[model samples]
Target: MNKLLCSILLATSVSFAGLISTTDVTVDGVNTITKNYQFTPNPADLGDLSHDRATAWGISGVSLANGETVTGASLKIENLRNWELNEWNSLFIDLLWWAPEGVTTYKDQNMGYGYGKDDDYFVGKESEFGTVNLTRLNYNVFSGSDGMYANPSEGVTISLDGYKREGFNKIFPLYDVTIDFSDSELATLTSYLNDGNFGLGIDADCHFYNDGFNLSLTTQKTSDVPEPCSLSLMLIGLTSLGGAFVIKKRK
Candidate 1:
């Protein structure tokens, strides 16, 4: 009887044990997803005096088990370039999540979505995740302290020498920007994935010239474990069984 009880307890503990796994979510190809965008300054634009453009990509092929829980997530952007002619010209990059009603891919428009006056640009179609300010556009120097800047309030990190330019006209260089999601953000992302509405929107002012970028997502998931209350009840039941068996043996 003791051996049987121990076996049952061991089996229960194993059943409730949590298993962790990592998943890479990307588009275009497995482990290799990329998107290219070119923003040209509209000299005749009246709104904001700069042309703001937004594009979105929907993530598919995400498969989660029934009891899987997303614990952490991150988004990585590679090879971001800045090619504004004006030295004082800098732009803000806004990361957003497209609403369920929003279009996943470019449609009806030639150059993605253009920002107009007020919040009329986003309205009820998209929600902002965070914003990154690209400062010091004129300086060709490379360093995190001088050339690269990231909004700390947005909970994102910009690596050193993230901005690069070759010769006089080439701004293409290797740099990575990673955004780590908080706990609450992970929960929201999980819900979007479950609904098949997981999409990322990139909105930026017309400062970045023609450039291609690679994007990849890292996600961590944990298998469901038994709740504390349930485990406590199970322990109580097991203790009672042991007590009853001991009493029977004494008799």
Candidate 2:
């Protein structure tokens, strides 16, 4: 029985393929028709305080390909800046998959506050960033040195480790937000596979410190076959039944 179960596990493992891709980063629910922006940490430039002003950033692209079923997916971003002066406080971040109302196009030429402008931007203020909450995670938190673990707040938390403007240890480790899709959600995603467009939302409640984070999205193709754990359980149940039948025959 053990050998049979092991063979089942190995077979299921080889039946699936994994794919990783990135789309243009869109902000505030505006689809990236022309361009997308990316943020990276630089200690020298404070003049272009644009990345620091954005309340959210996301990717617009194929979350699942044709004929592929999503077994697992994850969103990864670097929490580059949290400029709060308070030392005791930590930033709590939420990752979401979203949809927008109507069609809106926003452009950013410079990807900064002064250079780019979004005329059709949907989120007006922190109070009104309604689109972000449209829908959304199993998330794990870790530092560059610390091991990953589930956080208590159900969101990633970053501590204020240093002072602002100088010697700021704002470079947080990668924030990995696992995308958990229910059976119905997986069915819904099939409708969008052709267009490959989906809304990714990020929110840091503090409002001011929600900027300067980089984004990446990943999707893994899951096989239709049962998982090893599930198969093992089923096999165990069947073996028990077989054992009972043998005892009855011997009696």
Candidate 3:
């Protein structure tokens, strides 16, 4: 009995250690799913008020089952370049979602007359300069609204001064920098995901090119249960201990 109990204890400890080693429980362990999206537009498409300008891409391929909750999220911007020489330029970024009676949507330049672009230009519908419930992630100098959307009480600004141009034709590429979402932002994203509508928009004040972008989301189930591997280890330990007791009784 003493040997059996020792064996079980050792097995349980090893199992838990193995589980902790392989999983980040803080981020919800194996329940996390990260999706990367590419957003390399034509150089002319961005940074130009005329010709090809302002673009929005819908976030797709995210499938979460009922009761699963979004715990964390992030956005990765790659190789953002500024065209101005020795002058700081600002890039506007918006997190877009569908809302009833909402004024924000992606508009193309070829949409014709009366379809003028918004102040932010990237995530706004024709002539509509602000988002519905969503907010701008980056500051918009042109709007002079100080990062607030049409709703002045909402929204937050993320500065990218590190990537801005410091000299003539200077390019500061951000390869590994990831913008982590706050708790409130993650909650908003969860709501958007629940509603089946989400998008990311990008627009630059001066000549700039965004090499690409990647979005990541991590989610976990509401119920807390032991992982499969840990459960298996526990079961095996119990089985072994049971067999040992049976042998002792027979002897």
Candidate 4:
């Protein structure tokens, strides 16, 4: 019984679900899952977002390896559901290279997002970061201080679909963009530049284990909640009840 409960906990904690709204391109032959960025600078700060300057990041998507392409395909992101990592040892962001490179190896941050910045060209996670290509980019450090996320209240979300016909990031009829984190959450241009890719294929088959990420679950709500054990029990019951149908169906 203990082992069974543990397995249930493991599965519930590690699983993810996504909805596919569009299917223009087959995400099958996907070789690598990476991120691409877009930058559009906003000169005059309107929202008083408290930054030197701000750029909007656009399209910049989560890449899937070749032989892995499909629009509107429901995706699952197990890592982001309820996960935690061991700081530097078990980081949350994946890396493209393993040779201890700089930050320029990936793509540039799309400064197009509208926001506030108080300096000349804002944002930086790594100093010596380089670029990889015109589309994809990487970053250097993974788990240190807010290198690029210094003033996190500034970076804009990557809008794959314009919310209201080019107004804000929205989901269309055949598309459900399930971003792992908040739109404001920084996936800095410098990070992509330093790492080149978002650790898509760096799994067992690949040369390294830099593919997955390790996260620390902060307080999810805006206020207090139940205790950890209490919350865990509630989640267990909910998860079990929720999956009852699927399990029964499989049987």
Candidate 5:
């Protein structure tokens, strides 16, 4: 290979940034039919990592294809742990398979996870950025290190750009929003959302990603209905329907 030509190609490739192809599989209502992303890393970069015991773990950024081209992918996890079961928080995550990237996240990513910050003492957080209930575990998602959890007001919409600038960029790669709390859900969601742009806010720096993700799940909140906010939607819908009926009657 010509040294000068190789350098030129590399530079040009980096400048364009490729795209990741995502796909979705339909199942039914209320439940999902897919999860996770899949990608084939550069043969050279794949190197010995695939076989390296030390490198045996979840996917990495290097897997991302050049020009937005992704070599692998993950769920857009936000508040990714909850339900204090035993002595650790139940890990949480979201679906990112439908995000603009060609990758199957679950089968490829889950190969390496569950090794806690200190020994195997906690539930490893999973994908699909959504509400979690880690209070049961008694331990925060990130205790020793490389741990993070989020709690959020379910059904609410938020802009992730702020979270991105604040370090929640990992969860914002795709614009698809998921609301799940189980490992299965994580894998399912990531696989289904393989090509969507979900605005997720995950702060992956701290061993705990302690960005304060507060979610008002039904388990914790005594009242399902928050006062002053109940009558808004139903009332509006009913009123519109009534007006339409009256107009029809006059005609």
Candidate 6:
């Protein structure tokens, strides 16, 4: 019985650690461009002066099983062409989730959908983050506003310099921005995942000479495993039944 219980306990032991990454950037809806700049400072009517532009990227199919929790979430964005590291002071990044505004799926990447920034240049369809004005757009950050967020008040802001990584041949720098989710925040996130509505949004705030930058989201998930004591008790009950069966057979 003791050996049986030991085996059962060992079999039930669980450890948690896994990461999910999606690069499906070719899809038009998944990759969104918001032209927000109203007027060009220089070049004098060469174009519409649409210098104020940003990108919002989302990763669908995010889910957490029973007893699982999201440990962390981060966004990796490619640096602008010919932009050196010293010019990164003006850059900013934000992480967001789909608000519970009847949004069943994350595939809605249309121009007016919640993915794009609501400004004079473009308009968003969903009301998950309210209007596209600067007040509603800027949330949980000291500076820089890209798009509207469901709960901007409930986000963690970090320094961009801390998560920077070098690309191939050190040509382009990949910036990693981590999102710190609290206990309550994790609960809310899990609820969304369980409901089959896992959609994460990433907003980048910077001035780029061209629209060649790339964005992606990476999230780590951990499951809640049963305690050792609980498993021990369950194994003991099963072992007792086995012992009784052996006694009956001997009799």
Top-scoring candidate (TM-score): 3
Clashes of 3: 0
RMSD of 5: 20.0
TM-score-best of 3 and 4: 3
RMSD (CA, Å), candidate 3 to true, equals: 16.9
Q: What are the clash counts of all predictions, listed in order?
A: 0, 1, 0, 79, 77, 3
lDDT of candidate model 2 versus the reference: 0.32
lDDT of 3 by residue, 54-117 (tens): 4444454455667766676666555544443343344455665532121112333432221122
Model 4, global lDDT: 0.22
lDDT of 3 at 208: 52
Q: Candidate 1, overall lDDT?
A: 0.38
Please write out the lDDT profile of model 4 over residues 26-92, one tens digit for every residue: 2333223322222111111111112122212111233434333222111112211101111111111
lDDT (Cα atoms) of all candidates against the true structure? 0.38, 0.32, 0.44, 0.22, 0.26, 0.31
Ranking by lDDT: 3, 1, 2, 6, 5, 4
Model 3: lDDT of residue 251: 100
Each prediction's TM-score versus the true structure = 0.46, 0.33, 0.47, 0.16, 0.17, 0.34
Give the Å error, residue 221, model 3.
1.0
Where is model 2 more than 4 Å wrong at Cα?
Answer: 1-58, 63-66, 79-81, 87-195, 203-251
Q: In terms of TM-score, how similar is model 1 to the real structure?
A: 0.46
lDDT of 6 by residue, 113-135 (tens): 12224432212422342112211
Report lDDT (Cα) of residue 28, candidate 5. 28
Please estimate how well model 5 matches the true structure, expressed as its whole-model Cα lDDT. Answer: 0.26
Worst 10 residues of 3 by lDDT: 10-19
- Residue 113's C-alpha lDDT in candidate 3? 20
Q: Is candidate 3 or candidate 5 better by TM-score?
A: 3
